[model samples]
Target: MVTLGLVFAGPCLVAQQAMGAGTDEVLQAQLTQIAAQHHGKVAMFAEQLNTGKTVGLDPDKPVQTASVIKLTILFEAMEQVRAGKAHWDEPIVLKPGDAVSGSGVLMFMDAPMTLTLKDALTLMVILSDNTATNLMIDRFGVDAVNQRIAWMGLKDTHLYKKIMKPATEPMPADQPKFGLGKTTPREMAKVMERIGRCELAAPGEPALPGDAAICSVALHMLRNQFYRDTIPRYLETLDSTEEGSGIASKTGSLNAVRNDVAIVAGKSGPMILSIFTYDNQDHSWTVDNEGEVTIARLAKAIVERWSPAGIDGKTLVPGLGLAPVAGGGIGASK
Candidate 1:
């Protein structure tokens, strides 16, 4: 029997906050009330890029990441392309055995079809395609993704295996605890911050020149992410399919868990929100799943508190207008 009171923690668990003076105590109070009212455990970390104001609940606590770990895979693909190790146009073949049923269109498509590496990656992000995710893992290797996570100085984040597949190597003691992967709210937010800032290289490493192009493509997929019921539920004003949205996000879900990490191009500045909910009593797979709504409420409160004027999609197109990074020719979404 599962319990709703479990609070997963890691050795790195410590109070993490940098809210400057005049911090929004009311906003924090609102967040606390929202978390307490939910029928599940919540962990979150959010930061405003311009002011560095932040609010968090168990920011460093490790939790089941579900499909959210795909962000690391997407990150690795970007770095590999930047490092000349992989090409976006590289061909990837998907046989019948590669198809796995969950959340994607690839399983219903004809088998043995060929797709470019970029296509698989886009599906992995926009649609959360499990088969597409497996193709990427097979091409790049899961260990490589973990290596990149380590390079980013994220200790609690790990991509344990591919989607719906068994691990062939030795398993960690906590393998069964977090099915596909695991991460802390703070660590995952760090990943989004890196992409938002277009800072690809690891800390202290010489910056990779001409790598802003890589960030553009990654952001493009994230901006077009198909699952919007979480963070984007109350943030988007226009149909993202037609006009594009100011939110670039990736969401993950399980029966009792829902997670979303996003980079928002707000009116004031860019903001990053990483939220995870677990031990939820509501396990229904409906749009109104309690965990999902909980995440959206948290996001709405945080964004409303910080960017009272709302988000600007225009800033998103130019890579959040981040310094030393500019626009690129991103392929149109299918």
Candidate 2:
């Protein structure tokens, strides 16, 4: 449901010739085919930040956020620090009640341990730590987080409860509609955009001098993202940290849902993308799960089609980054 103002306005208008008309035609055709052939629901929103060329496919449709909504928590944490309501270096003691399962090493560690609020935020984003998330949520106040979302003028984004909260805990009747949290691809993309632009903090709250403070921390944590099964799966600079521009992203995965939003530093400029897959029939958790593979392929296709200039010429083909390699050429699969 993204506006798709330029993509659908009339001609296949492009701000710059990153890629030509013929390539854009093929790319749009492939995206259409991808949406049509996907096994379940798919929503995406992408924009080249400088050029404003864009694409969307059901980008406004509501979807289960899985762990992706932790971003709101991250934003709120940054806000709290800026407001002096919380301190990033404040000490937090881990208790038995704080432990929760799924996608984090915190649960496996000993309880009654201690870490700073900043450390918890790091684990929350980099590891998707449910316990770290819940700890920070308690400090950040769940309602306060939602209020900030509304204040920022986003409607479909909301957090329902702490990660893996019990059924006995008080929550709204619609909690079942979106587990943990919910958001649209477009909304999530905007969140990233604000964070990237360093505009997430409250107005007049002394901006964090040029991505050196909160903005840098948030992006650094995202750049260290441990999960690479989706968005970064196809980028040329997946492993080596220094050779090429890196992907800063957060990914969420549930059995039936896989979502990722990222800010890619393209060779020419920055590009933002958000993609979500849900209601998927294939719920396998394998590296080759259908939904995961779908997102991975779609991400690569978008980059190749729209920003051919950004593509690293020596990288492997779109999805076969791990295939045995010979010195073929730029797009060589093996």
Give all TM-scores, in the order shown. 0.89, 0.82
* lDDT, model 2: 0.72
Taking the tens digit of each residue's C-alpha lDDT, what string does model 2 give over 27-107? 555765665566777778787676776666666777888988988888888777766787878998889878998988889
lDDT of 2 at 284: 87
Q: Which candidate is the best by TM-score?
A: 1
Worst 10 residues of 2 by lDDT: 316-325
- Over the stretch 103-138, how does candidate 1's per-residue lDDT look in tens digits? 989999999999999999999999999999999999
Stretch of 10 with least lDDT, candidate 1:
2-11
Full-model lDDT for every candidate = 0.84, 0.72
Report the Cα lDDT for candidate 1: 0.84
Q: Superposing every Cα of model 1 onto the true structure, what RMSD results?
A: 5.4
